[model samples]
Target chain A: MGKALAAAIGLASIAAAVTAPTAFGQPPPGAAACSGCHPASARVTSPVVRLAGLERDAIVRAMQGFRSGQRAGTVMDRIAKGFTDDEIQALAAWFAAQPKGGEEGNPARVPLPKGGEEGNPARVPLPKK
Target chain B: MTFTRRRFLGLAGCTALFPAPARGQGAGPRVVVVGGGFGGASCARALRQLDPRVSVTLVEASATFTACPFSNAVIGGLRELSAQQFTYARVAADGITLVPAMATAVDPAAKSVTLADGTRLPYDRLVLAPGIDIRWGALPGYDEAAAALMPHAWKAGEQTLLLRRQLEAMNDGGLVVIAAPANPFRCPPGPYERASLIAHYLKTKKPKSKLIVLDAKDAFSKQRLFQAAWAELYPGLLEWVPLSKGGAVTSVDAATRTLVTDFGKHQANVASVIPPQKAGRIAEAAGVTDRTGWCPIDPVTFESTLQRGIHVVGDAAIAGAMPKSAFAANSQAKSCAAAVVTLLAGGTPAAPKLINTCYSLVAPDYGISVAGVYAPSGGQLADVPGAGGVSPANAPRATRAAEAVLAEAWFHTITGEVFG
Candidate 1:
């Protein structure tokens, strides 16, 4: 089902790409919200797909597919329906400019503490049953 | 820069005769943010990212922030409390001055905040991300003292452990009761998620035990999905009572672990009463909250409608269509930060695009979600037509498993972005 939907949306994008206009400027109004789920860096291990550095056309196509119910998604379909074509184009342009991969020695990256490990004092011990 | 009389007059209920302190030559505008949860921390970082010139200071009472999102997993015995805790060490390293002190008062007329230790910090723009504070005594017999006996694990710290311990210590056939509150509460789906996880624990550890949810609301977020999951995954072990069926808890007796409704009184061996909530006390002291006990704000910029030069995000804000969730708070903080930056630069902020997506787990591998995309419409936030809804009912287990993975990923990515 997923493959068939992707192929169908692929064909639809080819036709839409011919008329799509390039959008650029300060990041559009809603662009920052996407990073809540889609990580900015490739090194961030997330099941949600990363959006940085993707082809603008690809982002536009995926959004259109989600909006039109041609693509299967848990939440993206609902979110995609909220954006207009212009807004999507603007967001696509902004995300395409970001780095697709993580910086090697980025001091900003902080490792998250692992959950459920035994013998770690920070982990709250389970009550004796 | 001179303080303008017009700006002074714009401040509501101001009686101060003194002017705001002048900045040094070529100094950037100063911004003060209170509370270091998802909202304030995100805004503090976003401000530095948007404009390096703005001098930002964050005032938080605690050295570490305990996130409420995954704290439920801790209560359910699936995760650890340490995983939900984060420090602002990296946030401070990102050019923000961290003031580790409690904000005791806010003088809007003077545009300064007074800390508990007699320190006053002034700012050109102030952001209050004070999350919800339980309205003790609103429901008779449910107060701070009662919380010690019947824990309300809503704030996600010691209370979380208290409730977890109670559940673990109960005998095999003990009855567990969760009293859920009415509308406009933080994490609309939280009580249900807690119920689901606790039910999972009871089923595994104490097969003879039973759990009951007495909800104040007749309907709830992700109702269809949650009810379906409960029926399938925990048939005889759990029961949910809605408002129409006498679920609204009017009062409680902590000493007896008894919850009273209009219809009858129910007693339990382990009780979790999530009392009614209001905007954090700091918001009230700041004079930004309305009669609804929540702060009203301009949907586009999240600036408090009741007080100029102050913005309120997170659970405290009266966001029209947005539920009080960590994801929504993070989104609002970023937008508010961008607007504050623009205003400081003497430019108009563009209309904001706000979004919220909340993921809840019924079991370790069974997850569900609800999402919405909102924009300012008719002077308030409204959901765009044809957009946003919950996960489909009766989905294949693979779909649920996939969402469960994504839910964990969401936690990692968001916490990393704000704190890491």
Candidate 2:
């Protein structure tokens, strides 16, 4: 019964996750919560483009750039390909409405298990000549 | 699974069972596709879109899909995991029979597949796109239990959510360790993408938190591209230990959260072990594992040489010069679908051209890729010269940024093609 219950819960979460509302169909508050890393603050001089100051239209335009091969050979094309037109707008709106440094919404990390370890490691063999 | 006009008729006969007739009409040949990731979804959907006569049934273990392709952006906070999801409804809406069941075994001789629930699904042509499977015990001390404590999150589902939750909940200044398996696995650039995204989160959310990558390969899929991005964009926050430096993890004690390496033992606050992979177990059980853990297929037909009537595509079938990528799987699925359709239409499979270009996002504006177009030569698929290859290592920064955007667009287009 315990195993069955656990499996039930596992399956339930699996279902919930697949249908999670925060990000799949529309950009939820979560998308807005990541602007601190690359905000387009006037003082912010990241070589990376900042999405914070961009409007919904611009962000969508940027994503579309990747899609039509205009922004050729870029990963943005791959990322942009993941959403529907409606969902893309939601993401753009959610992010565009935010100010620079608007980061939040990260949950706490579950402690690593006593036996949990890296699948493969590479930093230890004596350095090869 | 001999192709016949009668089999196609039977497929048409089942549509009467649906409330609404699918987008296509008539009985086509019978095609059973297992797994709904890029490959299964693509093959099944393509069969219907390319040729309406074929009856396509897709058996996916889950109703909804959490794509591995861009889950990294979810990790980075640049994109939501929801954006990386699709429903089997798209496949169903496209008139493919979408079955939510795990494919357990295949009887190639009988041309039938046994589902986990003991349903026997017979087919004229069986397409197995169950993706790659983790050889669990390949790394000692790591088992399913250990995964709970430290998630591999390789298959892309709730653990993806769980990993995201853990990343969220970790205290600022915390340490997150990512252990990447050696090459020839699903989504070659996934680990680096994960690290970059995770570091992006840590840099902002935790401030002092760090992302440590313990990689098993000598160098990564796009080492220079990733290194340049990490240095200029995420310096001091992301660190990588390559295989040459003892980054190859030999074993793990999930209970102890300790990883044993040739160098020594070190523990982390969080660990994700993506083990060495093989063709999904059904393929192995169906007699597909060669000296390598993958099946070598005739690129033209994607037929399993070891067995008749079964074709393996995606990460299961080995195609040279093609990384085991989502784009490759989707492309392979289309070719497989075309071949199956041609044979069903009372014709021989055509000599096919397969195309794939995988995008890895470093930042929203930064991306890199490897593109290839393949044709059969000397019993194997070879990249057509000047058609596809890795993005130039020394591309201008702006160009790299452009590729990142294109990568996202490609993801949208390809996934739409499959599950849209």
Candidate 3:
């Protein structure tokens, strides 16, 4: 029984890692930073330029331009000063991988406990608007 | 007690029906957030989004939230007060329990908050985002009574309306004085933006009227961009007096509509003396704030270093490099919510990355901004080495015009995200 429990724990750990690649099962690193201003996809209310679904290289180029002062931006140049080439690349890749409409808000931080998923009668559902 | 297949199956069914708690972890962790501003509201929503099992209750004193991000535009008459207002219908629909009551006290040991009516709401984790409260007497003779006469207009809502009315009622050539506070205030660039917007209003409506900024600090956020815009647009109409130039206002006589600075007493048709500020009273009551009058927290989790299981975000926390801006608060709230969810599941929190973009509208057609990306390192949030900056100095009209549109869009989208 003890050995079986250990094996289940090991598999669950791997599953969690596979399901949640980012730290803390939250949005990809740097996603929240863009959320408030750019969001994902495009909206009439969105002010900043959208980056989701953009080619990785294009995003990298814009970030590099801002970093090097070649790009004229409201606050991008200053903001770009905070990232390295590698971090910028990572951010670019993450955003590019996202769906056009953005991730469904943010994912659950931890996997649902056994028997507590959507269909579970015990689960407290969101209120209807 | 003997282990048998039939007995084991029966016990397993019982365990499945009533699951054991995760070691020492509590069952269905409840998170309570106080104050529904950018930080608290975002945290509450993110908490629900991050873990449906983790119950979230949001305690807000006001029925409707008034966003400070664009309240300056409202004060400048660029936008209406209604535009800055928002309801919590969406946030509630997202599964967070909305408690429309003021949190009067926090008991850390019990993990509960006593509301104004003395209802105790318990929680496994508490996020306090009670934003800045003005140090009313910090500016001499500037108390609640004086604020009624000379509106600070800092908190938005009624104060914003008061200032707007004062601006409209003033005569064409009357002088308007705006007394700006020192560093580490909410929206570091706000006073200057207000000045720019007020100047825009004056230029179009009352060109002869002049506005002066009596600043406590010698420097300001986005100084060069604002100065450049002021020079090109309303050159002589707007003037800024730095602290070294005797611009520091020491006191005000609201009855006489006069401000006393190091230089001398200056009278104006209207005055706005933005007072110095500190973390909201609830933070101190919760024992999260320290000698600096701001809460200190773990940079990654935003958990108050002073109190375990309690997190602080937004203007109240001494966020190392991040300014107390709405975007910063929203970003921190997301990260903090993640941390709370992780801890509730008996897991360690990972490092967090945050971003802040603050845009200031100098005119209806012009906007400028400062932005930065931050990460928790060396126990503090430090800006990424090469990631953020301000809008170019003396940029072309098109760029500023585009930024203006972006600023509006940002305001709309962020408010929607926070409230919708």
Candidate with the greatest lDDT versus the true structure: 1
Evaluate model 2: give its lDDT.
0.68
Error of 3 at A34 (Å): 1.2
Q: Candidate 1: TM-score?
A: 0.88
TM-score of candidate 2 to 2 decimals:
0.71
Cα RMSD to the true fold for all candidates: 7.1, 15.3, 12.6
TM-score of each: 0.88, 0.71, 0.84
How would you encode candidate 3's per-residue C-alpha lDDT over A1-129 as one tens digit per residue?
255544543343343334443554566556666777776423223535667788889999998997887996566667766655655776787778876763332221122234411342322221111
lDDT by residue for model 1 (B1-420), tens: 243535643432131212234445434678999989889999998898887777899999898888899788888998877778888888998889999998989988688999999899998789999999999999999998889878899999888877888888889998999999999899999999999999999989998999999999999999999999999899999999999999999999988889999999998888899999999999999999999899999986788888778999888999989999999999999889987776665555677778999999999999999999877765677776668999988799989998888888899888877887
Off by over 4 Å in 3: A1-20, A40-74, A89-93, A102-129, B1-27
lDDT of 3 by residue, B84-135 (tens): 7777877888878899998999988777999999999987789999999988
Interface RMSD of each: 8.3, 19.3, 15.6
Ranking by TM-score: 1, 3, 2
lDDT at position B389, candidate 3:
71
- Candidate topping DockQ: 1
Kindly list the per-residue Cα lDDT of model 2 for residues A1-129, writing each as its tens digit: 255544543343343234333321222311311221233223323334567657889888876776565885333444344333554565577667756543321111122245522342311211111
- Backbone clashes in model 1, listed as residue pairs: none
lDDT of 1 at A109: 39
